[model samples]
Target: MKLSRDIMRFFIIPVVLLVGIIVTAAFTVFYTTTARTSSGKIISSNWPKEFTHDFSEYINIMNGTPTISDTGKNLLVKNDLWIQILDATGKEVCNYDKPSTVSDTYQPYELLNLYQYGVGQYSVFVSSVNAGDTAYSYLIGFPLSISKVVTYVDTDRYNSGKTLIIMIIILTILLILALTVFYNVVISKSYERIRESLGSIASRTYKPVAGHRFLREIYEGLDTLNHDIALADRQREKDTKAREEWLANITHDLKTPLAPIRGYAELLSETNTDIPFERSRKYGAIILKNTLYAEQLVNDLKLTYQLQSNMLPLKKETLNVTRFVKEVVIDILNAPDLEGRNVSFISNSEAATYFFDPLLFRRAVTNIVVNALAHNDTSTEVSISLDADSGVKLTIADNGNGMTPQELDDLFTRYFRGTSTEIKAEGSGLGMAIAKQIVEAHDGVICAESMQGVGTTITIVLP
Candidate 1:
C-alpha cells in the first residue's frame, strides 16, 4: 500500500500542476475575453463592426442632408457610443451623439490611429456609408473603459493585439494537451508491461521483460531478480529430490544389515539344533560384519552433519602420513565384501608427516576406497598412491565403472547418491561427501577427474 501511494504521488503531482494551469488559463480567458454594457448586453470584440454594419441600414440622406434615423440613434445610445458622418475628403459632414474630444476632420495617420487605438479618450470605428450618389462615410466611437494602450506597430503588426494574444493562448493550451496525452500513453504502456511481468512472476511463469526507454533500469533489475529466483528454485528442487533419495538409501542400508544380524541371533538362540561350534562362530562373524556395516552407516550420517554444522571435533596430531593412509586402505580391504579385491598402494616418499585428526582422516580414506570397490566389477584394479608436494597428495584411481559428467559434478554433494545400476550398493549415499568434508575440515582440498569408459581418479591435497 505504501508503494502504491508513492507511485500515485509521482504521477499525480505533475498532472495536478498541469490541470491547475489549464483551469487558471480557462478562467483568465473567460474573464478577459470581453466586456458587458450597463444595460447588461454582451459587447464582444466583433460588436463594434457588427453595430456599424447594422446601423448603415438606418442611415441615408434626407433632403440633401446626411441624416441618421431615430432607430440608428437608438443603436448608438444602447451601446453608449457617439458617431460622425464624413464626406469624400474625410471631412466630418454630420454628427450624432458626438463627444467633444473628437475632431471635425482627420489626417491620414490620425484616421489610422483612431481605427487602431482611438483618439486619446475614445475607441472608434470607421466605415464607408453610401448616402445616395454623395458617397459619404460614417464614424462611430465608444467611451474608453480602460486606459488605451498605444502599441508600436507596422503592417505585420496591424492585426488586433488582443485577438493575437487570445489565439496564442488557445494554441498553447492545445499543444500542452497534445504533449500531455503523448506522455500519458508512454507511461501507461510501460506500466502495463511492468504489471504483467510482476503477475507472471507471482504465478511462477515469469519471463524476461523487454527493453524500453522509460523505467529501463527498473526493468533490468526485475530481469536480474527473475533469473536469480529461477536458479534458486531449481537448486532447491534438486536438493529436495536428492535428500529424499539419500533417506531411502539410508533406510535400505539399515534394513540390509539388520535382517542378517537378526537372523543370526535367532539361529544362535535355537536350543533344539545342536549347532556346531564352527558354525556358531561363523554365524557370529557374519553378525558382527553386518553390525559393523550398520554402525559405519550411522557414523557416516552423524559425522556428515557435524561437519556441515562446523561441530565436528578434530583432534589434530602429527603422524606418519604414509603409514596411516596405508593402514586405512588395509582396514577397508579387510571387509568381507572388499577382501581379495585387486587394490594397490604406492608412495615415492613415505617419511612425510602432517598434523590432523587421525580417526576422522581414516574414515575419509576408507569411504573413498570402499566406494570404488563396492561399485566396480571384480576384474577392475584400484590404486591408492601418496606423494609429497608442499605437503602430501593422496590419490585413489580406479579402472572401474567411472561416473558420467553429471555424476562427477555432484560427486561431493552431501545427499547425492550414485545413479549406477551395475551393483546394488549399500551404505548411506553420503560417502564421497563425508570424505570431502573430513578432508576440508583438515584444511585440505579434494577434487576428482574421470572418464565413463576409462577410469576415475579422486585426488586429495593436504597441508
Candidate 2:
C-alpha cells in the first residue's frame, strides 16, 4: 500500500479497533462457556432434590395416600414433575405415563443428579425418595436444557460483534479523512513554493532562495529548474547584445572602405581630358588599397566565425620566438602608415623556442601592435619587449591618451570604443577581442594596465 493510505488505515484507527476486537471476543467466549458450565452444575446439584421434595409435598397434600398407586396418581396430577417409585432392593415399583405416551422405567436405590443424556444439550437429574415404611422409594427425574442459556449468550455476543465491527469501520473512515485533509494542507504548501518560483521565473525576476531544504525529489527538481531558467535568461540577454554589436561592427567596417572606393570610382567615371596621369594613378591606387582592405576585413570576419564555431584547423610548428618577434617588428616599422612612429624592441631571451600555430599567434600579436599605433598620438612612442621567467612574457607599451577604469574594464568587448576616440574611425573594434581569444587558445593570459593621461600597457603571458 502507499504510505499515506497505510498510515491512515493502520496507524491511526485500526490499532484501537484491533485491541477492541481481541478483548471483546475473549470476553464473549469466556462468558458463554462460563454460563453454560454454571447452568450444568446448578441443575446437577439441585434439580434432583427439587423434584423429590415436590413429589413428597404432593403426597402429603393428598392426605398420606396409603398405596403406591395412589401416590403415583397424585404425582401424575402434577404433570410438571417427573416421579418414579422404587422398592428397597433397587427394583422398579411403579412408573407413571404422561399423556404424551412416553414410558418411564423406575429403578431402585439409583443415585442420580442432573446428568446429561442423549445428544441433546440438557441436564437430567434423578433422585430416590422414601415414600412409606414398605421399603419403597420414589425416583424423580428433572431435566434442564442449557441450549436456551447458550442461545441467549450467543445472540448477545453476535450483536456485540456486529456493533464492534461497525464502530471499527466508522472510526477507520474518520481517521482516514482527517489524515487526508492534513496531508493535503502540507502538500499544498510545498506546491505553493513551486508555484511562486514558477511565477517569478515567468516574470523574468527569478531569484533563488538561500539554504532551501527539500524532503522530496520534486522539490529538488523544481529548484534545479528555476536555476536553469535564470541562467538561460541571462544567456539570452548576452546573445542579444552580442548580435547588435556584430551588426554595427560589420556595417562600420564595410562603410569605411566603401566610401573611398565609391569616391575614386566616381572620379574615374567623369570624362575630363585635363586629368593628370599621376593624380589619376594615385586615385586608382587608393581604390585598389581600399578594395583589398575590405576583402581582408571580410576574410578576418570569416576566420573569427570559424574559430568560434570550432571549425578552424590548427597547423602547429616549433618556431624561435626571438627571431619571429624581431622580424614582425621590422615588418611593421616598414609599413607606410607607421613611418613616422618610433617602434623599438627589447628582448632578454636569446633562444626562446615555443610551439604554436604561427599564423594565428602572429595575427594575435600584430593586432595588438596595430591597435596601439592607431590609438596613440603621433608624437608618442610604441615599445615592445619580450621577457621570460617561468615562461614567456610579452609587453607592448605606448605613451598615449590612456583609458579610465571603466574603459579598461570593457576594453576587450567587441565594438566598444574608448571615450577619447572618434567613433567614425575605420577600426571594427573586434581586434582586441580577437586577440584575447587567440591568446587564450594558446593557453595564455592577456591583461592591460592603463592610467588616464599616462600610458597603457598590454601584457601577454604564455606557458
Candidate 3:
C-alpha cells in the first residue's frame, strides 16, 4: 500500500511494457494478415501465365494412354509430371498410375510453375472434357526445378517477423524514456519545494508551505509536515521572547537590592561613632547578605546557560536518595536567609538509589526547596519525601500564598515571577529555570501544582 519510488518505477515499467506489447501484437497481426493476403493475390495473378504453354503438350502426351504398354506407362511415369483424365460419365479414365509413395490428397491442378527451370519453378494447369451427356475434367502438374520463388516467400515472412519485433522494441524504449523524463521533471519540482521550506525554517522564517499548488497526495503530505515544523518554530520563538523578558526583570531585581546596600555603605564610611558604628554595621551586614543573593543568582544563570548550550558535562553515578535529601535539607537549613524557617523530612526508607549527576541533581533539589521557603508568608512547614517506583520523587509542598493559572503557566520560565508577588523579596527568578534545566539534563521531569489561597507543591521525578 506504500507507494515508494522503487515501487512506482516497477509499476510504471510494466505498464509501459504492457502497452507496448498490446500495440505490437495488434500491428503484427494486421501486417502479417495483409502481407499474406497480398502474396496470395500475386501468386493467383501469375497462375495463368505459367500454365498456358504447358496445357497443349500435356494433353497430346495423354492421347495414347488407353492402349499404352507397361513400358510406355513406365516412360510416362518417369517424366515426373502429374496427369489425370476423366470419361464421358465424369469419372476417372485410363491414366498414368502414380507411385505408392505419392500422397492421395495432393492437388496437382492447383500447382503453378511460378519459377521456370534454372529461372522459374513448378507449373500447374486445369483442363475440361466435353462428353455427349457428361462433362469430364483433366489436371496437369510440372516443375521448373531452377527458380527460387520459395526462397523469396520465406525471406518475406522472415523480414515481416523481424520488422514486427524491432518496432515493438523501439516503441517500448521510447515509452520508458518518456516516463523517466516526466517523473524527473515533476518529482524534482516537489523536492525543490521541500528544500526551500527547510531553508526558510533554518533561517527562522516560520511560515506554512502553500498547499494549493500541489497536484499529488505526496506533495500535500509534505506540505502538512512543513506546517507542523512551522508551528514548532513559532512556539520556540515565543519561548525565546518569554525568556528574554524574564532575564531583563531578573537584572532589575538584582540591581534593586544592590543600590541601597551601596548607598548605606558610602554613608557609613564617612564617620565613626557608637550610633554611626551600629548603623554602619547593619548596612554592612545587609550589603553582604544581598551580595551573596546576587552571587547565587549569577550561579543559577551560568548553569542555565550551560544547559541551554548543551555544554554541561554530567558525571553520572549512583546516589543514595535518602542521604542526598538529608544533605540538601541540612544545606538549605544552614542558609542565612532560611535559618528560622521550619522544614521537615518524611521518608520510609533509609536507602533509595538512583543514577544521576550528583552536583546538578543537588542544585535542582536545593532550588526547589529554597523557592518554596522564599515564597511562603511566615514560618512555613516544607515536607520532602522520596518513593521507590524506579525513580526518586522529591515533593516540596508549602503552605503559602499560592499562584494563579496564568502565573503557573509561566512558572518554570527563566526569571518569571508570579503576579501579586513582590519582585524584590522573590529571589532571582532563575532558580526554577535552573532546576528545570538540571532535572532535564538528568533525563528527569519537574512539575508544579498550586491553587490560589491554599499552597504550592513542586514535584521532581528523577530517573
The global C-alpha lDDT for each of the candidates, from Candidate 1 onward, is 0.81, 0.67, 0.66
Model 2 misplaced stretches (Cα beyond 4 Å): 1-188, 207-239, 266-276, 419-424
* Candidate 2 weakest ten by summed lDDT: 112-121
By TM-score, is 1 or 3 better? Answer: 1
lDDT of 1 at 175: 86
Give the runs in model 3 whose Cα sits over 4 Å from its true position: 1-159, 177-185, 188-225, 271-275, 309-320, 330-343, 353-359, 379-381, 388-391, 398-406, 419-425, 449-456
* Candidate 2 lDDT over residue span 1-463, tens digit each: 2344533453445446656776898778666544223224423333344555555544321233323456556545543444555555555455554223323342322233223341123333444444355534554443334332213457778888998988997897677667756765555555566667778878867666555554466656766887887788776776577658767877877888899999888988898756788998999999998899888877777766776776877787888887888888887778998876888898887788888888888888888888788777678788999986457799999888888897897777765555445544555566787788788778899999999888889999999
**lDDT at position 271, candidate 1:** 90
TM-score of each: 0.57, 0.55, 0.54
lDDT ranking, best first: 1, 2, 3
Largest TM-score belongs to which candidate? 1
Best by lDDT: 1
Model 3: per-residue Cα lDDT over 1-463, one tens digit each: 3455744664577567667977899878765433112123322334443443434333432443323345544434554555555544334464554334322332333222212321123343445544344444554444322222444457777878998989988897787777866765565566666666667657756366555465566556655766777788777887788778767877787897789778877777666533555776788888887888778778777888899998989998887878888988999899786897888888767777778888888888888887787776556678787775567778889877788898887789876765435645466677788889988887889899999878889988876
Model 1: per-residue Cα lDDT over 1-463, one tens digit each: 2345545654676678888988897778766656666677656656666677777787778776788889888878877888898877888989987978788997778788778877666678777767567787787887645333456777555666768888998898788777766776667667767888888877788888655768989899878888888888998998898989888878888898899999999999989989999999999999999999899888878888999999977999999888898888888888786789999999877788888899888888988887887777888899999997468899999988788999998999977777444666566778899999999988899999988878899999987
